[model samples]
Target chain A: MHIVVCIKQVPDSAQIRVHPVTNTIMRQGVPAIVNPYDLYSLEEALRLKDRYGGRVTVLSMGPPQAETALRKAISFGADEAILVTDRAFAGSDTLATSYALASAIRQIEKDIPVDLVFAGKQTIDGDTAQVGPGIAKRLDMRLLTYISKIRELDALHGTITVERRAEGGVQVLKTKLPCLVTVLEGTNEMRFATMNNMFRAARYPLKVWNKESAGIEDLTKIGLKGSPTIVSKVFAPSPKAVKAEIIDTESNQPKDLVVTLLAKLFTKKPDLAHDIAKNAP
Target chain B: MSETTEPRKPARKKVELDPKLARYKGVWVFVEHERGQVHPVSWELMGEGRKLADKLGVELAGVVMGAPGEDTRTFCHQAMHHGADLCYLIADEVLRDYRNEPFTKGMTDLVNTWQPEILLIGATTLGRDLAGSVATTLKTGLTADCTELAIDMENRSLAATRPTFGGSLLCTIVTLNYRPQMATVRPRVMAMPKRDESRTGRIVEHPLGMIETAIITKVLEYIPDNLQGKPQLAFADIIVSGGRGMKKQENFQRIWDLAKVLGAEVGATRPIVQAGWVEADRQVGQSGKTVRPKLYIAAGISGAIQHRVGMEDSDVIIAINSDPNAPIFDFATYGIVGNAMVIVPALTDAFRQHLSTSRMAG
Candidate 1:
């Protein structure tokens, strides 16, 4: 019944600004936060640990500052925290990332058998949604992604029933334990850290691992070298050829504006006019 | 087939396609159909696929997998008119309901057997679900929610451009070593190519070796969503979107009121969508819908690259945030820096006054 939740510390994309000169993200003053989506996964893992009376360990991979993210997870009531920070691990893609995470999990399993692993459905920064499955593939663990609800878990039988989100509807699938689960947002609410747990999180001695400590055997497979996919370049989206045609109404009348806008829009695309008239009350 | 980064273009080296890559042939657009009808996004992908095929000098093919019926065949033919050079049909009774196991098996079978260098799928809820599983099963890389795709003249690499940094920046990804460069494009990002009814393509049919009872997932019931009150922002002619500029959850009511008057659907930024103030489907941002509403009224929304990626395609972008410095004003045609709560209600009343009178006068 022991659980592990993986979280990442990402630049608050909301507040991130690009340097005009460098054309790179300005991170000096940017505040980092645990990915918003990871909260649901962490909370779900904490809930299962609470119900099953087991321990939960939170793990993060980033710069040394990522220790704060691990501490934040502990404050949220995870029993233990681990930080896998290494210079070599930087610039890793989803493929290399899954390798590092899976290696760390295997190391953890050597000490204590992990019954379940939890991760966010996808990272906002990457949005690849590949790490979870990649980790599952490497670790040979069953993957249940975009899970909305955990209907039941039978510890004795090592079986779990969960509802997975498909394209149009929910897929109620039952699978075995020692697997990985990626939780979707709105699945559960995150709880505020109590005064007591906040103190514990502040004091929690984090276990930091580097390339050697993480049990990464192949130097080639743990970072950029291990990554098969590469980001060739980044640039701004090209603007549209023609600028938007503004609907002008000299009358300064709100009704005049809305009507004029519609008239102009439908005049160019007459089928749109039929749709609007049909949907009108 | 050639893998040579020919030093030619200033932007970057040409994608080097190996001469051995000649074995990889045909363009495949994964036809994402469900229920009784195929999703329109499939047709959109087909249109884009035709261009990629034309560049590679290969036949454009559509891979349609669904339950056994005429609908699956009908979709294959429809795909051809949309510019497919061929259709790869895999229909079975078990395929009727969309299941990961059966659908993944069917697709991977066609891919491993036929060897397509490029695979495209619509970035629908179903598309992401199916693409993830198929890519994993095939051990191929998939770039999701691509905003652009191009062929490298040198290496013949399928250069996939997508919004990154939560849509703040755009990054181009290339699957260098992988055979089939798999990608999923969101709906509306690509223009629907002209459909030619006179166009024809070869049809290749394959059998779904499995039966219905063998599939693990059973479609017990489909609770049809009540269509009366759903936001049809994707198909709407005018979308009056709101954001944090509305300030509070309750203030969105004014935006809704204005939208109702203009016969428009309401849209919001990602933060608003994440806040549970609006449905995720109605969210307008990089991670949400790529909208092309005729008239986009962005109330209280400060335009970020993530939010801009979704609504930048609109015919008209009218921004109404309290701060003129808000990025929304930069590209917006009509910028009104005022309280959305106040401005939205005023606009709502104004539209009602204007539209109602115009209806009578006309």
Candidate 2:
């Protein structure tokens, strides 16, 4: 079995902050790391490779610096890494993105047939969760998303069974092989890299593919030209003009504070107090 | 994912939409259901769809796909009560369970039969899973997790506004040249409209010409989540969330105490959940559940944009933090500067007493 995992490099969201004055992202100090969600997908793919004795190839589409993410995947036990980057692919939205990545996957299929494709549920930056399905539709593969567990995989029959998370219950779905699966977060814990794997990752000669090398011949379908949506305006959410009314008391003790706050709350909204009392279970 | 190596070129001019898409009219909301119960978010979208439909002087319709039973027909009636002018119904045995293939085919077939200019769906797991595939198959643009939806009269396109750049900024996206502009809004982000039982509308029936054998994916088993002791923060009227400022897991118990006294749900930030102070299901933020409660009491939360966007829509916000300059204070209706450990226990006791006294009086 040949499994391909798609990953992305995104800024660590915890360190991301907005400038108070200009309302722009403060990206200077934020470090770039593998998308936290993608790690789960990569880990799932590696575990499948371990069980089924298959080769896992990690793929990403980003700038040259994204090679670090691919190498990190290699350290996690991936057999190969490919980075798809190009000057013409700038300003691409999810549609253009899936097109480029799908084209790259087709090129990879020339060497070996890929039985399964894996991707993170969504990226932290876009959080659209559209690329996986877009790629699945473009490739004419069965798309299974928000998969929580891999119940069974019958490679001989070209069939796979998995549990998909739905609104109120879990749906155990069985689909054909050669499909795309978007793994959900918290599905599995990523494994720690071994020293030998780290050394191999450091020396692994990565495959770099551009738009031309990835077999994307349609210029209009690879970048900004293919994106149907446009951002008309980007602005900070306006803060509520009036600040919260601070309750003050003579003594700053917890008892005094509670009394004062309750008095004010009841005075302002008598119905809330009554409702809470009435609905007390 | 590529970066611009050279100077960026000027923005491209808007392209003329295909003439074929001009015939698409009306706005449709996909009414999501599970185990014969319609999700409330579907009704919320129906209310919002009414506004969009009225603005364009077009009809508002609800799309319902389910088994051939009374439940499906009842949902179509309820859809009209919630402001839908009509409903498109598709019934089949294959769609009895929520498999991606049959549901997607049913929805896409409806769109193709009677094209709707704007389609709104709830951003639940099932909705998200279905909308992406349907939109991709139709080769159109879809905006997910949109906080705001408006019709741009200039070009008569849907303007979908959602948080971008990790919730630091809001960007309004428009699918200028795509027909049946699609968007998914999370539950509770939109107000639930009052239902009018007296209202009735037309029901348009469509057939799902799919068979069990033809569909490759099969539903093996379904295990419903155990909701007995779990926190239903998404629909909770009141939520008390803790952040990193709680210091330790023991101190986090104050949140549970307060929630108990007030009959509210307990929520925690991502960091707190990561630190094992609370379960992942109780986390409320961008990465967690989006909640809009009647009252939200945030303790020790610094009001990071990610967490703020999730609960900012609550009717009333009360923030307690040591730092007065915390972003929570910027939007909170009431703010207290102090230790959360101290404030939380006192509030719980006060509510406990207040409720007991009221019960005695009544």
Candidate 3:
């Protein structure tokens, strides 16, 4: 019943800013936090470990400083930590990312066979929501994304039932063990780390794996070259020179403004006026 | 359980098992079908994928799975009309119902054998479920919920741009090394291409290959979704949408009141929708429905990128939120920085008094 929680170190969204001139994000000096979504995954893994009596391993792929995220994972009750870091692994997209991770998980398997893998539904930094599925795919495991609940878990039987939020409603799906679960946000409230756990995390000796150590054989397949898609450019969303026209909040009363707005609005969209009149309060 | 002190396993290098994934060619879009009808998002992806294929100079194709001769091919022809150069139709009895195992295998087998250069699917229930399994089986890169896709001129590759960081920023991802760079686009991101009835494409039929017995999961019954009273936001002309600025879940009732008066679909920001105050289907954001309402009244929604991506294309956007600096104001056609709780009802009252009275007077 050993569990693995995969997390990413992301620039805090609140502090993220796009370079006005470059139209690219200004990443410098932005403090990194555990991707908000990944926290839910970590919390879920911890809850499972507490109930199942198994050790939890926190793993991350980032630069050396990203060890902080792994340490933070330890503070939240992960028993072991692994940081897959290398200059080569930089710029890896979901595809290259999954390749590196699958190798590391296999390496971790030698230490302890991972029964369950937990990840955030999607990283704020990479909203593609592909990595979890990619990792699950590479590992040949079942993937459960947008999961609202883990209705039941029969660890002994290697069966898990969960509710996945679809477009219109939810679908209750069942899958066997060795599955990757990407948790939806707001699924559970994260608990505060105890002082003991915090101290343990701060001092924990993390295992840092380079590309070779991570079991990535083909150097070309683990980074930018491995990626088939390339970002030719990124620009800020085209902004309207004039923001939304201000409907005077003060001079014109709400009721009066409503009249002018309706007059102007209906002149433009006559059908809307008719539609509103047809469905009166 | 005690922590195991087992030593790590030595690395085993296998060349044959991990050989360069080869022979896979072409670009395919999964024509997502559910409840006997195909989702429009599938067509949208085909149009988008058509551009990506043309850039790579690859043939654009559609992979469809459904009951034998059950309008699936006609739907494939429709896809060809939209943009597909070829349609890979897999008609099987097992595929009539949208079960995971059969569709996953059917699509995966087609992919493994054909080795499409790129595979696109709509980010729908059937798409996501099937994409996850197929991508996993093929062990390739799969991007989801992309706002933009392009062929990187430098490499002639697919450049998938999506909102990263919960819509706070955007990231461009490439599956440079993987064949069939996989991605799923949310519906409405791409404009549905004009269909040409006269346009024709070759049809290559592929068998489901795997039998029903080979699949582990079985769909006992579909319980077709109850659509009788569903809100049709995508097709709505006038929409009264609410966001977190409404401050309280109960305040959404005001939006409902206004929408009821306008006969408009009620929409909400991703946050409010996720808050359980409304249905997820009513969510209008990057990960939700991209709307084109004729007249849109947004109550209390600050335009986050997530919400903006969905509603920005509206014919008219009128924002009403208490915060003057709310981002929704930036793109709205008009703005009123006052309590939606108060502003909405006032607007509602004003609309009722004017529209009803005008009707009576006329």
Candidate 4:
């Protein structure tokens, strides 16, 4: 069985801060790391490899620096790593992105048939959750998203069973192989790289594919020219007209502050106190 | 994914749209229904779609796809009450459970038969699953989790606004030349419209030309999420949320105590939830639940844009954080720059005593 997992390198959004005066992202010290959600899918793929004894290949599309993410995946037990990068792929939206990644996967299929594909439910930077489905549609693969668990995998029969997270329930679904599964976050804990594997990751040579090597012949379909959506404006959210009223007291004790807060709060919105009293146990 | 930060090309004289695409008209909101009830986000989109339709001098229509039954019919009427002038109904047994294949086929076929310029859908689990496939199959642009939707009259395009960089900034996106501009808005991002039972509209039934045998994926079973004891954060009247500043997993009990006294729901930031201090359902942020409770008390949360977008619309917000410079203060109704560990307990005690006194007095 051959399982291909798609991953991405994204700036740590948690550390990203907005400039107060400029209203722009302060990207100075924001470190780039593997997209957190992808780690779950990669870990799931590794577990399947451990059980089924199949080769797990990790793929990514980004700048040259993204090779670090691919190497990190190798350290986590993936048998191979591939990175597809080019200037022409810049400014691509989800549509263009899936096109590039799907094209790359198709190229990879030339050497060995891919039985299953795994991707994160969504990327932190994009948050679209469209690329996985887009790739599935383009490749004519069965799309299973928000998968919480793989109940069964019958490689001989080319069938798979999984639990999918829906709006109000979990759907137990069965489908034929050559399917794309977008793993839900918190589904599994990512394994830490062993010291020996870390050494291998440092020296491993990654297969870097340009647009053409990835089988993307149409320039218009891989970059800004191929993107259908255009961003017109970017700005900061306007602050509320009235800034919060700072509550202060002479004692500055928690008890005194609460007492004063309730008094002022009830005075301003008298009905709130009554409502709270009526609702409380 | 399209993070085009480069300055947009200067606006030119109104450019003429493609003749084929120009034929597209009306605004369509996919009416998402489950368990015989339409999701509230569908109504919210209908309300939002109505404004855009009126602005463009077109009609607003709701697209309903589900089992052929009375329940589906009721949803169409509900859509009308919410503001749809008409509804396109595709009722079939194959679409009963939202298997992506049949639903995508039904929606794409409908778009082809009756072209609509703008397509809006709720950004729920089902909606996202369907919208992505439909948009890709149709080769159109789709913007997800849009906070604002409008018509750019200059070019007759749909201007969809959404947050980027993990909610650090907002960007307005436009589908310049796509025949059917597509976008999804998260539940509660838009206000629900007032419903008028007196309102009714025409329902156009269409055939879903697919059979069960043709579908490859099979739903063996569906385990309904047991809601016997779950956090109903989205609909809570009052919410008490904690952040990392609570310091440890044990500190979450203080939040629960305050919530119990006030008969409020418990909420936590993404970090706290990720730390397993609380269940995923209790998370309140851009990626979690979008809540608009009447009273929201946030302790220790720094009010990142990701968390702010989720609850900024609460009727009254009280923020308790150690840092005076925390972003929560900029928009909170009342700010207390102090230790949340101490203040949370004090507030809980104060509210408990005050409510009991009021009960006795009344």
Docking class of 2: medium
Model 4 misplaced regions, further than 4 Å: A250-252, A264-279, B10-13
TM-score of chain A of each: 0.95, 0.97, 0.92, 0.95
Which 10 consecutive positions of candidate 4 chain B have the poorest summed lDDT?
B4-13
Per-residue lDDT of model 2, residues B1-362, tens digit only: 11211212321354466788878999999999998899999999999999999999999999999999899999999999999999999988888998778998999999999999999989888888888888878877788899999987766788898888677878887777777899999898899999999989999999999888998888889999888997799998889999988998999999998988888889999899888888899988777889988789999999988898899988788899999889898889888889998999999998898888878887
TM-score for the A chain of candidate 4: 0.95
TM-score, one value per model: 0.88, 0.96, 0.83, 0.97
Q: Report how far off residue B131 is in candidate 4 (Å).
A: 1.1
Interface RMSD, model 3, angstroms: 9.4
**What is the alpha-carbon interface RMSD for each candidate?**
5.9, 3.4, 9.4, 1.8
Residue B160 of model 3, lDDT score: 76
Tell me the deviation in Å of residue A66 in model 3.
2.9
Please give, for residues B3-100, the per-residue lDDT of candidate 4 as tens digits.
55553564234768899999999999999987777898999999999999999999999999999989999999999999999999999998888788
Q: What are the per-residue Cα lDDT tens digits for candidate 1 across B151-266?
A: 87677778888887777667787777667888889888887788799988788998778776565444544444456877777767889888887778887888888777777888
| Cα lDDT for residue B305, candidate 3 | 75
| TM-score, structure 3 vs. true | 0.83
Show model 1 residue runs off by greater than 4 Å. Answer: A20-22, A239-273, B1-11, B14-22, B92-94, B207-228, B248-250, B274-276, B321-326, B333-346, B357-362
